[model samples]
Target: MDDPVTFARKLRREQTLPERRFWGLVRPWREAGLHWRRQAPIGPYVVDFVCKARNLIVEIDGDTHYSEAGLAHDESRTAYLAERGHRVLRFTNSEVTQGGEGVYTVLMGVLGEPGAER
Candidate 1:
């Protein structure tokens, strides 16, 4: 964790279940020219997924994110990203695991594709 490069590399190698699932869902989008990078380092943080072209960062929050300290940290991190003009989208682990279709639909909507009714 001392080195940001090393930390990002480790995160990519040890992706959580939700992270793995999310990546699987979006990997093919690269062919459509929606390039995304997993465990991308932006500033001092390593975002779960980032599409620089769209200025979008998607984060999959786990249990710890609900705690007071974690929430505070996330708030600041989000503010920092916003200051840099990046829009952040956060999804819980449960949301991705149990409602994957819904998550995919939301992402499609954010990506500006048609037919994302909800």
Candidate 2:
């Protein structure tokens, strides 16, 4: 398995729009109580973002994710994480970019509190 730091570096080199938005918000959230790992591998997949402190995974999907096949793939990924005792939260690219406050709210809810200590 790749180390989290190395994975994060790789992700930075290949940054995407959704990743930038998610990481923008994730930084503050990490300081509050959550620690997120980018491109963190789990089982046979590399999750978008993972907060092991909370056993949570956050996925940001792009337009291509609207396809039927993409949805099915996401469902399977979520199920895999669930089976591994992790909670998965998914958001679209637009949602994270245009709905920053809403995204933060949802993430806070999942993380338990705005100032939750893990």
Candidate 3:
């Protein structure tokens, strides 16, 4: 009976290793003046990270996400967010763990310059 709010809180506390790793890199973006939220609830799902200002949601997927069910759910989630005018960025756990600079570059490209607010 864990509600979304409580579940999101638990997720924030128990973030996966990749989530933590990526957060370390992305969190510093705030210092550059870009806003992002971790373990944020959008509609029904609690996305791993989101920049509402940019209408972006970043999800770090673990092994479970490769399953058929997980893939279907993610597709639905992405479709829903897209319907709401939000863009979704999905990264596998290893991608964040290994592709540090690459991933950051991609994010920066999508996010634009730090202080360059839209």
Best by TM-score: 3
Return the TM-score for each candidate structure.
0.91, 0.83, 0.92
Query: What order do you get sorting by lDDT, best first?
Result: 1, 3, 2
Model 1 backbone overlap count: 0
Q: Which stretches of candidate 3 lie over 4 Å from their true place?
A: none
Q: What tens-digit string does per-residue lDDT give for candidate 2 at 19-116?
A: 88889887777677656788877877878888887788888888877899988988887898999999888888888888578888997777656566
For model 3, residues 1-118, the per-residue Cα lDDT tens digits are 4777898899999988898899887876788777788898877888899888889999998889999999999999999999999999998898899967878988889977666665
Candidate 2 structure, TM-score to reference:
0.83
What are the RMSDs of all candidates, in order?
3.0, 3.1, 1.4
C-alpha RMSD (angstroms) for model 3: 1.4
Better of 2 and 3 by TM-score: 3
Worst 10 residues of 1 by lDDT: 109-118
